[model samples]
Target chain A: MRVLIMAKEGEKSEAATPPTPEAMAEYQKFNEELVKAGVVLEAGRLYPSSQSKRVQFNGKKRTVIDGPFTETKELVAGYWLWQVRSIDEALEWLKRAPYDGGTFEVREVIEFEGM
Target chain B: MHRAIEAIWRIESARLIAGLARVVGDIGTAEELAQDALVAALEQWPTEGVPERAGAWLMGTAKHRAFDLIRRRKTLDHKHEEIGRSVERAQESVDLDAAIDEEVGDDLLGLIFMACHPVLSKDARVALTLRVLGGLTTEEIARAFLVPVSTISQRIVRAKRTLAEAHVRFEVPGGAERIARLSSVLEVIYLIFNEGYSATAGHDWIRPALCEEALRLGRILAELAPAEPEIHGVVALMEIQASRLVARVGPSGEPVLLLDQDRARWDRLLIRRGLKALERAERLGGALGPYALQAAIAACHARATTASETDWPRIVALYDAVAQLAPSPIVELNRAVAVGMAFGPAAGLELVDALVAEPSLKSYHLLPAVRGDLLRKLGRSEEAGDEFERAASLTENVRERELLERRAAECAAQGTAG
Candidate 1:
């Protein structure tokens, strides 16, 4: 099964402060582990909600909205696309991520015909 | 003439296609070119006489056809150039005198990885692996699983298309990727072996042909990935289990329990091979993985000259290790059996009863069957008969159902006699 792991935002506000070199190195090591395990098909950090855009279609009327949208806890800092044997296996790998304080939510990727 | 061509195809098709796939970089095209080579063989071999190096003849023909196809698709200059180099390299080494070379092993390994790629669904992987690597026809695969031929054909077609569309590499993956991919390949092989060892719904108790194919694949895998202890472990497990194939069924194809099987009928050669494989696995191991542990359990049984003399405690310990590595209700159930034999019937009964509420084991026939055996030993004949009846009703295999019903009848007779 393939799963998408979303690294949820914490109280520290990733948008306000830049990641330390040490934190970046730690993340790099973790990413390497994921790649080595052949689980992470793709993984990347978002440039904070400040650089995001959302386009909503309300009955064919396009409403454009820009981010730095107020819900900090709901924001996703980064995500990973992983192919693992089971949710438990995915969780086991995720448990070893180097981050000190953050939550990760795993959701199965829906595969369809021709995908 | 057709039979002779089929015999040649069965021996050469996997390597022929693998070599072609390596050259052309597309499994679908590789298969088509290989089929074309087979057609060429049918046309010429009848009159021209079959070549002494028939595998090389097929490979050479397939490679040349691949070269032609590459030339025909000259619209993509870069693809033509890239594939042209590989095709030319293949042509350089195309010596009919050296029919089966070392490179064929690597090519076959690459083909096995490709067929069992995780990009394909489980059913698709099984179908494609059996078709390409196992040298089985769509009809044969269909008949083996009792699925429609059209379904099998469609699965193979779609699997090839998926591999092409997904741009799955033709070469075997390296490092951890290889390990991840190897599990899927091993799983497909084991599934095939298990199906053959115990047919789920068929009238026959066992389909020896599927078992033979799986064993062949496992042996080849052991050769290709000698460093991987789990590969050796799986090979050992299959080899040891296969030794019992001859004794698993009676003259009339009735199911034979393991303890009741005629030990004299077991294949001693296979048992020896199995033990050698187990040793190889142990030599390379950090700790015995699930397969190796199971193989050790099988080895314990094989070492015993008689059923009563079997080392139940050692088997129980191996099962304990297996349960630790790969815990499943099925493993727990098997461990329970070992525990029962090693300790007493009540001990096994306690373990089996604890699993009665397990949702997964509720419909599994073995749970109730094991329960029935324990109950019968404990002199609870009426409950044992009911458990046996439940097991008989749950099982889909005709022969197994008959065995269970017979056990149920025995319980009833014993209860009445008492």
Candidate 2:
């Protein structure tokens, strides 16, 4: 199954740049491993929530709010698409991922057709 | 035909969806494929006569479509050339039925884990679990929870996204993870059964189908982890509670309180099954887990032939065990009831008074309702009537409200007669 792993937004120091050289190297190394194992179908870092806007539709007119939003309970920092034998396998791979300062969010992508 | 298909799907959809998820590697896709297969079944079954082994037919059809999708995706992206080649090579030798049969358990468990993942908030987890495992739709879940359908939908979408983003494993967690995850799983099942057993809203007192589904899932969990005492406790509790389903409502689906229920109408078979499960839980040993202790209390009531025959002391002792194992104001409240029955109404009244200041029980209608019952027993009819009225107003369930109101009226009538 394809699982998404997100780096938490709490690692503010590394939010803009890799906080430490070692952390960056570790991140790159893990990415390399994922790519080689064919588990990493796609992976990328997300822009910090600071620059984001949540567009809310109250009727037809859309209202946009600039971050920092009230709730930072969970914010996506980065993600990886992993192909694995089962969700357990996906978790095994997640345990190996680089999480220098933040939590990882893992989820299965829903596939739909005739959309 | 639609209702029949829906009924069948409700029973079989989780397995179908889980199987599809395993093969397609994405739940969203798997659900779509499953739906596609369902649509096909709807069109074909009425004309062809529903096939024997209908579940297998759905699985086969879903699997075929899933394989086709995988093949198409692999081939469309030359990037997956190796996968494409492997799919082509495997097609000739692969037996789909064997594949489907082998992975169903993991898939179902995976789906359950996914629904119960801790990443989502508690409300979200319960909503999603009921929707997915209980085969309830968004509207049904919302109606059950007394929430807007949009809110439920958002919760589900966010929950799924959270699990996906958190990289929460679809398969059941093991060791420490399982232990941690177990609490959430147990909580979800509890909420599901609670809604079924005593619905929070709507006209009915019990949604038996929901109760049965949750009980089945609990039993499956017990089988999956035989050594988990709490799982058996939960199963036992569910089984015992389910045994009373037949007696819980009148012909018109009105509420029937435990003290007023017809003992003769209660299913002896279910009580037996429940007692057996409780025994299994006890044999696992240690202090009685919260669920087992609750089941023990239920067993006490089940064993009694009539209200007067109830072993109030044993039930009170079981409640004390439950309180020690998992201390909650609710447990304390229940313990108070047992105390009232075992000793005198005044003793229970004192305990209930202490809980009035408890923040947790402040909004819990049952606290007032129990208090009212104790008051009535103590000859404080006026106060008891007021308490019942408050409880009736607080409760959202129509049947529960009506029952409370009736109790309040009875209290008033008794006071007038006196």
Candidate 3:
């Protein structure tokens, strides 16, 4: 089965500031482990909200918000498409990730049975 | 839908064969019945809307054929009459409902033992193992191993015929015999993995499907025999070695020496899995087997963040243990490499020098390659260049030869400058 493991960005976990080398190494090491296990099909870090735009729809009235949005409570910071035996296994991997703090969501990808 | 059917067949075919072989008392007939079920599925499934339980559907179809065989027992020849009698006996002992729900691990293990029975040649054992246990078609097996499809088909046919002729029982051996048979299975699996691992010099070396297949087999065996330390040991060893595949070759398809490989590029997940398997083997509590010992040595390299940080002495000690377990010229050569790193180039050169007179290693490229490295370290550039040239001449791999020749040229340039 496949699960998309996305962890929310913490208050201090914003990527606006460059990551320390140690942190980067730690993250890379963790990512490498997942990749080596053949578990990770895809993984990536998202660009910060600073370089993002938001469009709101109210009966087809488009309200655009540009630049950094202040509400950074539980926005997803990164995601990985991981192959795991179960949701518990994916959760276990998520718990061991390099994130200091974040709620991780494991979304099961729907597929035909036996695929 | 077609992909789903392939996936189901891949997962279910082995169990189907194993269960049928146990009931049918022979693998050849078991395979034929299974094939008939598969053929039936192909014809009916697309129109019938694939069954809810595809594997069960296949097994039920096969069992129905087995009953047909039972009814026609009176018309069979002498050998088949015996098989029919055995089937009748098996059916009497096995309740239909429980038989379908039976724990299949034992049957699968039996199938593994039968496939790797020492009566067959190593190539035949390998081909049959892949075909039966891996649920791979003959064409797929041939392509993976780079052999002709006809050859693989012939090997399978010959192997099954031999097993039938020899009256080989479709059951796992007991006690010490089981241990011995298990080793044969491990050796064949490891051989398949190595074939994939060594295909680095080829242009199409990106994903060695054989290695993946071998690993899948190894992982399944480990699960099926969790208490067997050697099983975990071999699994660990393969995982660790496989972890390095991404960094083991250069962009131009040249081999990368272990120390030169990018550590970050090594798969940490595999390393962790290997380490876990090693711990499991050790926890099983016995003197480490040859595979486990080798995994320990690989772990030493894996644990180190860099080449200089590697515990060379620990690796040397592990190699010493491996040499004790499986004393071969190859083990000695690898031990020399570890010894060199632990002591010094001079110390390593001494071990290499000893192996130089050994007949088995006379034409082995790595022996001279190790000798050349030691000589280079000792500042004997002129002699080192000659050794490298000899090593290059002995090697059949084009990329490796080029690398060795380039090393020889560097040594020549150094010799002239000095």
Candidate 4:
């Protein structure tokens, strides 16, 4: 199974301040777990909601609006996709993920037909 | 007069609604059709007398209503040619018995997962599950959750629109996808059972109708996926816990504590059924899942003749297994209670105090309630009174609050006695 890990809004602030040497080392240590487990098929942190966009479609017309989105829950600050066996196994691995205040929404990717 | 109609509807409405959903391919429309049939039955049953098979009559009437709906919609000549053809085909081949079995048994677990799909928020999932899968009226659900009927109605409407707009498939997922969907399915079942057991904000302590509905769904899931031990485990857990419903309340409707309940009043049939399901779960050959372990714990209580005779050590062990499977602060709190009962209050207090700084326990009422019990047992009556008072205020149930307050008074009386 491929699952996504996302960060809630206001979660990127910890990354904004220049990390102390020790903080930088801690961050490296965190990423090392993801790498060592071979679960980090792909991962990245977004630029933050201030640089986001809201896309809406009314009938056939598509409108894009600038963000600094008011609805913090609508934004994803970071994401990851991991290949795992089952939801239980994925949850077991998720317990080891380094999360602070914000919640990580985990979801399974819908496999396309004939893929 | 309406009560009889309601009793029949609660049992039969899910199948009617599911079958209608299949035909109409729109849950909102399906519900409207089912309600139409319900109204017809209400008006006719008194005059005509209730049919020999009330459920079959309801299903037959609802299917005819679905046929009527499709006919009316087809008259408008919709542009979705493929959809029209499928709806027409469904209408054409409408044998009541085949259709009933087809619709009623069409992957209920899938329907549950679809209802609790990740796109919807938790509140939305709960409202939709109650309305669609549980066959509960919006007003009934509103009363159960202590929310306005309009709020529940809006949640259901929005949930259906969101699923339709998202183009969520009605079919069950396969392989890893199925496993990923388990948590949502389990959460829905748990919510269903919890509402039935404690009825969060209602005059009743136990809503037997809702318990029966959840158990029926759980049993269906167990049969559908025999290889899924956890599904059987959940079914067993619900069955065993619900078996005590007969003994859970007094004739005058006050709540009955577990130890005070008469063991003879417990439903032996349900206990037997639960034990059988648990055995099937164990036969799957993995370390018992959280639900199965909890079922084992409940089975221990069911097997014991009296509270004094309970295998507290086995229950503590089962809780330990549950903690390993789903390590939550709540589970730890429960394990501490079992440990306290098995060993002594002091041992349990050690575990409970260790969790004082655990943030998740901050708002949980059980932490204070359990702490108070331990304190009372340890003869620290003054401290116990304070804890019980705090717990009483935190709990929302009127009956539970009253019981806690009474316990607090007892603690105070014990202090004076000493």
Candidate 5:
């Protein structure tokens, strides 16, 4: 099963604070395990929502919204596309992911025909 | 009638199971449904004079079985309505011909990936691939590998359960994941072909059935991933190698060295196909990958009318490129052989001697076998005889051992004559 694991932005987050060198090393180790296991299909961190943009389609009218929107808590900090055997297995792997403090939402990707 | 049904089932089973797995979301259940369809075909087809489109007929039957299975499952109460609605929709809209034509390719690719998933052990992967993708019976797989039927069956059953419990998806990954998965798929196919090309432990020198099956899988993979140059490269390598199969073994089933084989016995059709595939790989651009480079080397041999006409320098160059890309002791060893062919026995012996102390090749029979050949060429008959004897002792295949022993005897005869 393919899953999207989104690391939600923490409430106390400063803008785009990178992990410590030791923490970065731990994350690298975790990434290596995922790669070795052939579970991680794709993964990447997002810039602070401050650098993001959203376009809304209200019927025919279009509206452009820039990042640094007030809903900082709901912003995604990073995400991973993992092909695990199950959601439980994805969660087990996620438990080992190096993170300071951030909630992750695991959602199964709805595969389409011929995908 | 039973034989006809078995033959049709062998051809259609992999796609049937793969398509069913896409719908049912479980390979185990999909295979069961496919089996049920096969049973239906056995009972109905003989009486009904066989359907015009046998594959579609089997797939349609299997899909219906899947629907029935879902309806019969008591524990899936929450999913019953949702699955029922989709199943009903599928039954209404599914055009058997269209499904067979459009979905089979992707479905088979997905099946290949799932069978070779990294979670399973290599033995399990081989057993599962032969069982599922190659459409071989457990008994057949066992016979090919020289293992007990029960062992192959057990490996297959456990492999399926592991995939089920782990929930391995029925989809091919994209990007870097696709490349990684492709390598495993290619490796499994290569292992199968290698076993067939040179039986590691069996009395027979080659198992043609395994080679055919592996070649079939490689061809199918090339079709599915036409854009992937490595897929074509692998197919090219296997095809060129398979072209020589008829001439690879003696009339009494002894191993025939490449140079000693009757060139007229080589399959020209397969050689042409291999060269075409190699062209496709080369057209894709960039420096030749390991498989492609190997295919190029094989092509040089294929182009040669006789042993003396072989472009050894070109082969040596290709091997040098392969060694640079892969950089393994095995690749280096192969390079030494090419170097010997291009240069002389002394040069090849120097390269082979350099690897004698390399720990990885310590027990590898070919290291000594190559050394024996170079020694014989250099007229060091005593040393050559000893090396061939050592190689014979180390080899597992009865035919190879015999061949090595014969070479040793010939070397001793030369020493006495000189």
Candidate 6:
């Protein structure tokens, strides 16, 4: 099964500061462990909601909204696309992440069924 | 509830067994303990929510079971005292968190090497590896391979017995021994992938689950042996090959040729992963191994936005290197196909013709198939039709045979048109 693990922004914003080399290294170490277990398919940290855009559609009329939206709690800071056997397995792997008390949600992707 | 329990077991069984094996010396007993843990989980988990650390929970249960078994054996035999001491030592080593992780990693590697030991037959190795490392049930394996569940069970049962009788050490060999054994592990992994990628005799043309299992196993192997370029190479090859799996077959399950496949249908994530793996293999290179070389060749096709844009000459060069290393008729045949694409149909047909008298190529359906393709390209439709007919007659797969016969009829029509 494939799952998307979304890392929610903590109380301190993800865009607040650049990552230190040590912090990056720690994350890399944790990622290596996941890679060793062969569950990680892809992972990336987004550039924050400030650098993003939103498009709204109403009866074929489109409206563009600028970034720096008020709903910061709904924003995802980073995510990983994982191929794990089960959601519980994904949770077990997530618990080992080096994140500093970050809230994360794991959602399964509905893959197209085929023979 | 049972399905969820089984899924958790599938995910955790290998590690659970590995942890148990660290305490109990024998794999057979370790597996039994692990199964006991699984049964306990099935009975308890729904009432008590699933454990936060399901694997560790399973490991703890299995370890307790191991202790009970060791205690029972100690009363019967004096040798259990040594095993008891080892278990104590193992328990002590788990004091540090890093030590626990390190032990699990080593134990998993030990399990892999033990399952794929060269002492077992090829079929036995595949069966045992799937059972132990891939965490697959006998029934699942049997269904995937189109064999009776009894056959798979017997293979695993016998494989375990063979390992016990041979006294195969349950640790990854070091130095030159590690390198030699690594190839056997890789061969079995690839064999499993190929069986799924191109089914030799199954009704379904592609079995994605097996391919996924192989890729998972290969990636895990690559992680353990990061310095081994061949590990990354095989991973790269499997990734690239699997990238096209969806595009490699039609909606109705007919095989699709590489050039004919819809490039847009290929899995871009897998291709990216494949390219990354290939890059790693190249960076760690001395000389390119057979798998690395083949991966490089596959990358050529993968990098091409369209079939017409493929770097055929480069592929031909890579195939030459492969031929130099392997020195097999199969390699030569592949090279001939590359030569045809790079140069011309006449040149490819010339190479294919030389292999006509080869003893190894005599019964190979691909020889006639390649000959037919080249002949068709050269506009010798009548000869091409005959070749395709011969190819169709030799193939066992109903779909492949139908494809070959369709090509023959097309060639015949083209011949009559002339």
TM-score of chain A of each: 0.88, 0.81, 0.83, 0.80, 0.89, 0.90
Which regions of candidate 2 are displaced past 4 Å? A1-115, B1-11, B40-57, B71-93, B136-155, B200-206, B250-254, B363-365, B375-418
Q: What value does the lDDT take at residue B286 in candidate 2?
A: 83
Could you tell me every candidate's TM-score relative to the true structure?
0.72, 0.65, 0.79, 0.64, 0.72, 0.91
Error of 4 at B18 (Å): 2.9
List the DockQ of the predictions in order: 0.01, 0.01, 0.05, 0.01, 0.01, 0.40
Best by lDDT: 6
Ranking by TM-score: 6, 3, 1, 5, 2, 4
Local distance difference test values of all predictions, in order:
0.82, 0.76, 0.82, 0.75, 0.81, 0.85
Model 5 lDDT at residue B177: 96
lDDT at A70, model 3: 76
Candidate 6: CAPRI quality band: acceptable
- What interface-residue Cα RMSD does candidate 4 give after superposition? 23.2
Candidate 4 on B1-418: residue-level lDDT in tens? 5766775675566667766776677677777888888999999999998787776788788878777777777777777675687576675657647655654555355566778888888889878987776667788778767679899999999999998899776666788888768767867777778777774222442254466656766776676667888888998999899878758776655677887899988878679879988999999998887788989999999889888999999999898888887899999998999999999999999999999899988877789999999999999999999999999898877878888899999999999999
TM-score of 5: 0.72
Cα lDDT of model 5 by residue, B30-66, tens digit: 8888998888888887778778667778888888777
List the pairs of residues colliding in candidate 6.
Answer: none
- Candidate with top DockQ is 6
Residues B1-418, candidate 1: write the lDDT tens digits.
6766776676578888888888778889999999999999999999998786676788777777777777666546765576677656656665543543657768888999999999999889988999988778899888888789999999999999999999887898898898889999988888888878775223532255677677778877887778889888898999899888768777777778889999998878679979999999999959988788889999998999999999998888888888888899999999999999999999999998899999998899999999999999999999999999999999988889999999999999999998
- Model 4, residue B266: displacement in angstroms? 2.8
Task: Give the lowest summed-lDDT range of ten residues in model 1 chain B.
Answer: B199-208
Q: What is the CAPRI rating of model 5's predicted complex?
A: incorrect
What is the alpha-carbon lDDT for the whole of candidate 1? 0.82
Per-residue error for A91 in candidate 5, Å, reads 52
